[model samples]
Target: MIGILYFSSTGNSLYIAKKLKENLGGKIFYLPKYSGNGSEFEKIILVTPIYSFGMPKHVYDFLPKLDKSKELIVVQNYGGMVAGADYLMREYCTKNNLNLKSIYVVQMPENFTLSFSVPKFYLKKVLKKADSKILAVVDAIKNEKYNLPKKRKTKEKTYLKNMSNWYKIGKEFKTNENCVKCGKCIGLCPVGNISIVDEKIVFGDKCVACLGCYHRCPNKAIVYKNKKKKNRYINPNINENEIGQDI
Candidate 1:
């Protein structure tokens, strides 16, 4: 049996994981809630979004705990560029003694509202390409074609140098009066860094800067420094409840 473990804040990775399960036949495990040691499956697959060209803090924390004896595959979902996430995953696997079988990068819509908004037409095009790529990924996995790409030295080094900026990302987020106090942001936060305090949303330092709260806000109330909410993005195929169940 195969076990697919995924960490998705805005549902892009979750959508891919669901499709992988449909084609590859596996049990889907949400990484935040899963604590098993990978003993349940002959193969383990990790699907996650690229954060600052590296894995999120929770994913980095969880990697060492996985049973390294099982065959492992990693799929990274990115918006603009993957940078060095592939190399970072390979290094993590090597350090943990995990048999890294293959790595795939899928480009999804850019949900980073702080930087820019994804055009609707462009988003639709990306979704189509992502779906097609997922099918090919499933085929490769089935065939056990373990072809991992060589790391790009320059890009990887650049990503490593910029990774430290991720810590300050949460400090820029702010909600405007448009906020309905619906609490969707509180629940959608993967790290539970958002909360409701006296009818106002509050942010904590634990944020992994996934931007799920900003992208999934129903009223588009959340914004970054000097940036107004123009467009909110969530995986078109997944509903709000599917992405924000923690409430």
Candidate 2:
């Protein structure tokens, strides 16, 4: 059995993972609420986006708890240069004693800050290409048509500084009076970081900085820094239905 484990906030990585599952066969598992050891799959495909030049704390914390005997393929989707994380997958396997199979990088449009604007046609082309490349990799893994990499040392950083900063800056979630206090923001948080308190939306420290809360709110209640631009791309998965639904 193959275990496709992933962590996605804005649905880019999740979209890729779902596409990979469509191309290949694997049971999908999310990397949240980690309990006990992982599944007994002989092959594991780990996918996530980089957070501040490193793996997110949720992924890093859960990696140590998983059984490392599986063949591992690491996929990191990033916006800009993924500095200092080239050895992340191999290093993770080394620490946990898993066989490191290969690494693939897919350059998706930036969803975090949205500083760069990706033309719609170009974005579609790139995602289609990524789908094909990831499908080929999935085939190789299924057939064992690859060699495992050597275990190497990884640099140790607690990742607390960046995470703390993100939480500090990102905890500014607010709901407009238009908010019926429906609690959509609380539900949209994948990490369970938000809650409705005294009929008002409250954000907690458990935020993973995925920003799903800001997008999925029904009444458009949630607001982060630069709240004016909040509703710009609430749903980043710009497929046909979303465009129609928003219109």
Candidate 3:
């Protein structure tokens, strides 16, 4: 049996995970909600997006719990930069005793649209190309392709440094009057960093920077620090409800 454990913010990584499960017979598990090591499955894949050159906080914590005996394949998708994610994964596997078989890095449309919004037409073009690459990655995994990640000192250090910003993500976000106080973000947050306090939405420090609350907002109420209202980006291939389900 094959299992795919995935972490997605706006659906870029979810898009890849769904495609991989379509090609490779597997059960798709949401990383934050999934607790088991996946000892039942023979093959396991970790699909996620790179945040500031590193894995999301939820994915980073979940990686160590995976069963080492099963074959582990890692797939990371990013908007534009690769940022030495391969090396970071290699180091993580060594430290945690995980048997990482293959590592794949893919490019997708930039969804970080806190300030600068991406045109939907251009995002569609990017997704079209991404769809082709994802299939190729699936074939490679099927063919038993093995890869060794190259280590980079400078890039890895930068990656680690940038991760600190995720801790401050809660502080950077501010809700406008547009918010209906729907408390939707409370459910959408994978790490439980959001809640309704005193009948007001409150953000905590546990944010993993997945941006689910921002992109999946029904009223486009969440805004990043000091940024003018910009359009939010969600994967064109996946529906907003599916991403909001916290699966």
What do the candidate models score in CA lDDT, each in turn? Answer: 0.81, 0.64, 0.82
Q: Flag clash pairs in model 3.
A: none
For residues 1-247, write the lDDT of model 1, one tens digit per residue.
8988888878898889889999988788888877788888989999988877787766888999888789999998999887667877787788899888999889998776676777899999999999999998999998987768686542545555555566567777778988999887876677788888887888877767778888777777888885864777889887656652311
For candidate 3, write residues 63-82 as lDDT tens digits.
Answer: 88878888889998888777
Q: How close is candidate 1 to the true structure, as a TM-score?
A: 0.91
> Using lDDT as the measure, which candidate wins?
3
Between prediction 2 and prediction 3, the one with superior lDDT is 3
Stretches of candidate 2 off by over 4 Å are: 33-36, 114-122, 143-160, 230-247
lDDT (0-100) at residue 60 of candidate 2?
75
Clashes of each: 0, 0, 0
Alpha-carbon runs more than 4 Å astray in model 3: 244-247
Clashes of 2: 0
**Residue pairs in clash, model 1:** none
Model 2, 1-247: lDDT tens digits are: 6677877666667766766777777766767643546557767778888777667767777777777666678787876666556465556667777667777667765666533344567656666667667677667766767644344443446344676677764567666666787765665566778777876677887777776666566665666653554322322443412211101
Better of 1 and 2 by lDDT: 1
- Per TM-score, the best of the predicted structures is 3
